[model samples]
Target: MSGAETEPGVLVLAATPIGRVADAPPRLAEELADADVVAAEDTRRLKRLTGELGVEVTGRVVSYFEGNEQRRTPALLGSLLAGERVLLVTDAGMPSVSDPGYRLVAAAVEAGVPVTAVPGPSAVLTALAVSGLPVDRFCFEGFLPRKAGERARRLAELASERRTMVFFEAPHRTEAALEAMAQAWGGERPAAVCRELTKTHEEVRRGPLAELVAWAADGVRGEVTLVVQGADDVPAVSTDDSSLRAAVAEREDRGMTRKEAIAEVAVLAGVPKREVYDLVHKSGPGEATP
Candidate 1:
């Protein structure tokens, strides 16, 4: 008996090169030639890719994109169950990464099928690596809401996010998105706009949010990945007698009662409420009262 006939079927998730055909890994070609079924986000693109790499897929090729992923998952799962090697490749990058393939992976996992990957190029990491921003701790925000109000609200929520943030934006909406980001994250926040990464005409623009907004005003082109620096760490406030009293007074003026003001001030200044209360009391009635 052959190993392919005896071993359990496997689901292989392959990552296609985002750009630059030479980036395709060897394992990708090997699996393409050996798999029983090849599911691609775009079969036409897959054909071109195979031609460019001088590799031929012996497996049956089928479309597995956003529109038909759910409908096609069952059949693909059946292939895996029948001891057939099924390979899943997206148009670019890894499957289920702000792209199709999540549903199929989840289904495969639930069915006890062996799922593995052929790791390759990614636009997210590629942009971050060359973004000239902090990469140690970062978050991928995928794509923001397309509507103006929803997008604004979303940006507002991330205004204070401390980890460097990465986002994907359409070329046409790049200017509008940057303007909104500038409004929510402050004009001076540092960021990098990477366009057409890993391809000819690739451009990376790094500057304050406002500057990028201005640069994109006239127009911009190509696939865009925005990497924005996180919010600056808030400086610790001195908990001296005067500073504490001033903090409490400031909150009190903003409509907080003396007791409420002291507690809030203590939290902000990283001191005890009792300490803030004592400072407020020591300032005398004139300065303590809002």
Candidate 2:
């Protein structure tokens, strides 16, 4: 054989139901049954899903999640390089979208292994499709930072993003995330909060950010996905030092760092944040800023 190596095995990324088990696609069953090994974000959930789908998983199952993904990638790569068909699935949606499997996919690619996907249910696509927002052009932002300060900074950076944005948030933090969005993007921005998508209790609450925040005030539950309208082209606003300082101060009072505030103010005012930073610093620290 010319000493040429054989082609490596394939890595299959299978999408699981975001909520309703019925939404699981037909090809996923074949992949689960035929894969030489299966890496699941939650093995228990995998078992439950197989049972509900009336499918049997005959492959060796292993845990693969955010916590152990990096450490486990090498072993999975070994299996792939050894010509074993490995299938990856997450608790919900497709693997590697705010979930595990990215490492293994990357490793497999680097090793010249063929990688394929059995597209099925996805929380991101479902939310975006049903969001009634601008689907023509959109982006999935995954989850926002958990910490308040970090989350604020993240929102500020995206404040000027012209494409529609989607974010996943925990049930308990839905209210807070929406509140923060209202603060950063204005309350009147159109958005939809999709909860328990594809399930019996699935809900898609569509309205302005302010109204949604008030609705979520009492509490929100289940898998929460927020789809917010993108920023419209804003006419250049007055960039007087006093105005700039006040804008930065407003975000600061709300817990944003100076750098974060500058980035945000810069995007909003359509001016270079660096210029604002220099101007603000030139005014002296103690007199204008607190």
Best by lDDT: 2
What global local distance difference test value does model 1 have? 0.85
Give the per-residue lDDT digits (tens) of candidate 2, residues 1-290.
Answer: 58666567889999998887788899999899999999999999999999988888888999998999999999999998888999999999889989897888888888889999999898888899999999999999999999987888788777768899999899999999999999988999999999999999999999999999999998998999999999987445468888888787766766677887777788778789898787667776574442
Per-model C-alpha lDDT, please?
A: 0.85, 0.88
Encode model 1's per-residue lDDT on 130-193: one tens digit a residue. Answer: 9989999999999999998778767755654789999999999999999998877779999999
Clashing residue pairs found in predicted model 2: none
If scored against the real structure, what TM-score would every candidate get? Answer: 0.79, 0.87
Candidate with the greatest TM-score versus the true structure: 2
Clashes of each: 0, 0
Candidate 1: worst 10 consecutive residues by lDDT? 248-257
